[model samples]
Target chain A: MLEARDLACLRGERVVFAGLSFRLEPGGALLLVGANGAGKSTLLRLLAGLLRPEAGALLWDGADALADRAAHAARIRYLSHQDALKPALTARENLHFFAQLWGGEVAAALDALDLLPLAELPARVLSSGQKRRLALARLGLSDPARRAPLWLLDEPTVGLDAASVGKLGALLARHRAAGGMVLAATHLPLPMPGAGELRL
Target chain B: MALLARELRLALRHPADTLAAVLFFVLVAALFPFGVGPAPETLARLAPGALLAAALLAALLPLDRLFGADAEDGTLDQLLLSGLAPPAVALAKAAAHWLTTGLPLLLATPVAAAMLNLPVEAWGAAMAALGLAAGFLSLLGTAGAALTLGARRGGVLLPLLVLPLAIPAVIFGAAGIEAAASGLEARPYLLLLAALLAAALPLAPLAAGAALRVE
Candidate 1:
């Protein structure tokens, strides 16, 4: 459902990755692997429509994603290292805000991640690990009008503990079960079975 | 609609951030009397201009933070990708800023002016002018804030970028009040300030949204 042809990305004056091409069908996952500063985050942002490719085109279902930016934005959820949590808001409020933005079910996302217990606490008081879990819960929300979305995640498991990592795998599995796709850039293996890898 | 609501919720949750700008407005206007001395005539003459300038500067303090906070935490990217038009996001931010900072400054303008021995007759025009001027400052300031997002030393650079653009508001704002104080028709000055607002209402958000794309 997604395709990139000779995608050339640059950082400042340097061309981090060039002549890159990939295609992923619905329910597929692409694991990106490369050395530091090899443009994993850049690749995710490029696909998420946040950054334009220095050269190349991104196609969603045979249509130019760049040309139809709003459609591309609607169909994907890009999660970078930054959690995007408002520090002053409670955990549930933070999730609810994003859920409302994305047109997803707030309660379902919370239930999926077992975050109900910590919902009332302000995000500033949450530990890094809990914060990551909260972010993961945000990623779990689904728009019922559409099917589950395409995910462009940058090191999503960085602050997750083993249990949270396992929960993440389960979440991915559920998303895939519902015919969603993921393109995750990670240093550590995501334990996503049947996933294909692309080294930058 | 949702973006505006979310901004209001966040602002309500963190009232102190908005309060700081309002307090800055009060403090800056308060200090003008002390600096200019106890002469009521001199203070009255300075009140309209000083209050308008104070409100403009105070608005600047919170204006930069409108987008800066979200940009830092990656919320701006998410907002962009939330399928809402980028221009609408800029509009929501500009509106929230007015609600929090401009509205408070307008409400306090009477008390603030009174402290400087402002005549009761001029309060209506002064408040009306300050209200409209504050709205214009917010729209212009937000465009600057969005333009400077992620730039080095953006806070220091913001005023230099926006204040020049807002000079019309400052001039018309004080002029309207002064004209009214003399029992003259203030419509010409008020009309000019209103024209500024009407022009900026559509253009500023578009400029700020375009700036977001470049950033």
Candidate 2:
């Protein structure tokens, strides 16, 4: 289980959030909901180990998660607002780089997002939604048998269409069913069923 | 390394950055002959200084893009999260920058040296010095790039940050070539250049990595 206790965060000089707490178990999903400046993204970043909490502790299986950040980072797949793509690289090459870094099947990840048809195209030419799908393809690169346990997504559905959103929902379901966890920050209704909500 | 391979592939696809630096190196050296009037003795005397300056300035051209592009597109985040220690990320970038930008500058040094009317005998010494100079600049530039990342007018700030630190390499590189040109042993100057590179090889990336780790 992953748990946060009395978490607090500061962005610039302002306190974005404080006294925040949440728990995520194996095969669980949590949706972070709040208006702009509500610290949803900040919370996701904090949980992902990208940002350090000003106060409180993050525990994984009852151990301090932040104590070994590389180990904590190894278990997460974070998708930020930007697509994290090289515009000059072809879509397959883009996914291939990440696959090489994290150990996954590039072709399978591409197919998961139905991106095989556009695999040869440069990412610069991809539509905004397609680019988002390519970024989403990274999550599918995880090995089914040795998946990273936690996924932290920020505005994951921002540019996705209904069809792609459904595809993503299936991906999320498979992950949760396999004892993986998800914490997605979104203003729009996601296809996650039986997921809990955390309003910042 | 995956990051190195990606950086090389990206460099190949967008060869403009590498090309512009090489072209600038040659052009800057070529301009010295025009401005100083093409007297062989005068040109030869100015060759070492002129060549070193052009190479350093050309290398500076690409420093701003070193970490800027990755940070802007969120690639730096993925790199940070890749579980590769942040120092390794900076080191890989420095290696790639040296291959694409630094190697090209070294290759073009001969043409620039010829344009400056440098003695044929000094060509070897000049190439050696330039090679070390390129490597030193690559490490220094990587650190500078990381430091200036996310800053306003980073382009303007990059040279200002890098050029001062580069003076030692410039002095050693030019002196090494001048020593060899006058039939003197250039070992001390060359060794100093190598010492600077050796120090930077570990420290520059460490500094760059620390800067990158800052949220």
Candidate 3:
């Protein structure tokens, strides 16, 4: 389980959100919804242990998340707004590089994302939607079945088409049904059923 | 092992980059004789400095991509998220940079030496000095690459940041060669290069790791 208690996040001098608290149990899907400057990404970064909270604490299970960062990272995957694909490398090369880092199967993940045809093409030649899908494929492959239990996504569906968005919704639903947790920050209404919404 | 393999793979894929640096080293070494009038005594006297400078410039050419691409592509975040510590990652990056850039420059040094009219007897010592100096420069370059990450005009900024730091390596490298030519011991100059590498090996990575955390 993941829980944030009295979490206050400050971006520069402006307070993004203060005294914000939420808990996500196993098999829970919490949708983070807010305005343009609602600090949704900041919140997700904090949960991922990428940024420190200005006030309050984030706990995973019974331990402080920040205190055991490596342990936290081993079980959590955070996909940010930037997909972070290297344009000089091919889609398959990128997946292979990341798979080596996270220790997973690259071919299976590429097949799952329907990217085998474009796998040999350089990322620079990939369309924006295709690039996003490739990035998602990397994440799916890297997320170890036993280790990755929590996923934090920031605007994952921004450039995605309707079909890709629907595919994402189904993927999230399946992940949740398997006792994993997802905290997605999206402006659009999610298509998944039984997803809890938190508007910032 | 994995990081080294990745660096080698990246370098191999871009054969033009490695070839260009080697070509630059050879071309730059050849230019000195034309500029200074091809008198053997004068060429031999100026050989050490000229060869060292060419080697430094050639090694520095491809360093901009050392961490720049990974940082931009989000591979840096994944590296940070890996179980390895930031310092370990920095060390691995420095090693990779040396393997790709410095090693090639070291291999091309013999050709540059011949072009500069260096004495045949001094070849071995010159190569050894350059090997040590290149290692130090690679570490320093990694710090420069890290500092310039995400900055506007980073390509221009990297050389500015690294050139000054490279001065020590240049000095030691040239001095060691001159000492060898004069029949004097080159140990003192070699020791200075070794000292620089020792200090930079630990400090460069810490600076790089901190730079990665910068917003």
Tell me what fraction of the real C-alpha contacts between chains A and B each candidate also makes.
Answer: 0.71, 0.71, 0.52
Residue lDDT tens for model 2, B1-215: 88999999999999999999999999999999899999999999999989999998998888898999988899888888888998899999999999998899888888999999998899999999988998998998998999999899989998999899999999999999999999998889999999999999999999999999885
Report the poorest 10 consecutive residues by lDDT, candidate 2 chain A.
Answer: A140-149
- Give the better candidate number (2 or 3) by lDDT: 2
What is model 1's DockQ versus the real complex? Answer: 0.74
Estimate the TM-score for candidate 1.
Answer: 0.97
The true-versus-predicted C-alpha distance at residue B154 of model 3, in Å, is 4.5
Looking at model 1 chain B, report the run of 10 residues with the lowest lDDT sum: B1-10
Q: What is the lDDT of residue A156 in candidate 2?
A: 95
Put down candidate 2 lDDT per residue, A1-200, tens digits, no spaces: 89999999998899999999889999999999999989998898888888899999999999999888789888999999899999999999999988877888998888888999999999999999999999999999865566789999999999899999999999999889989999999999999999999998
Which candidate leads in TM-score? 2
Model 1, A1-200: lDDT tens digits are 89999999888889989999999988899999999988899899999988989998888888888898888887888887898899888898898877776657877787777778899999999998888788889887757777546988889999788877888898898888778899999999796999999998
lDDT of each: 0.87, 0.92, 0.82
Instruction: Give the TM-score (vs. native) of candidate 2.
Output: 0.97
Candidate 1 vs candidate 3, lDDT winner: 1
lDDT of 1 by residue, B62-96 (tens): 87788999988988888888788888999999999
The DockQ of predicted model 3 stands at 0.51
Model number with the top DockQ: 2
Enumerate residue pairs that collide in model 3.
A84-B73
Candidate order by DockQ, decreasing, is 2, 1, 3
Docking class of 3: medium
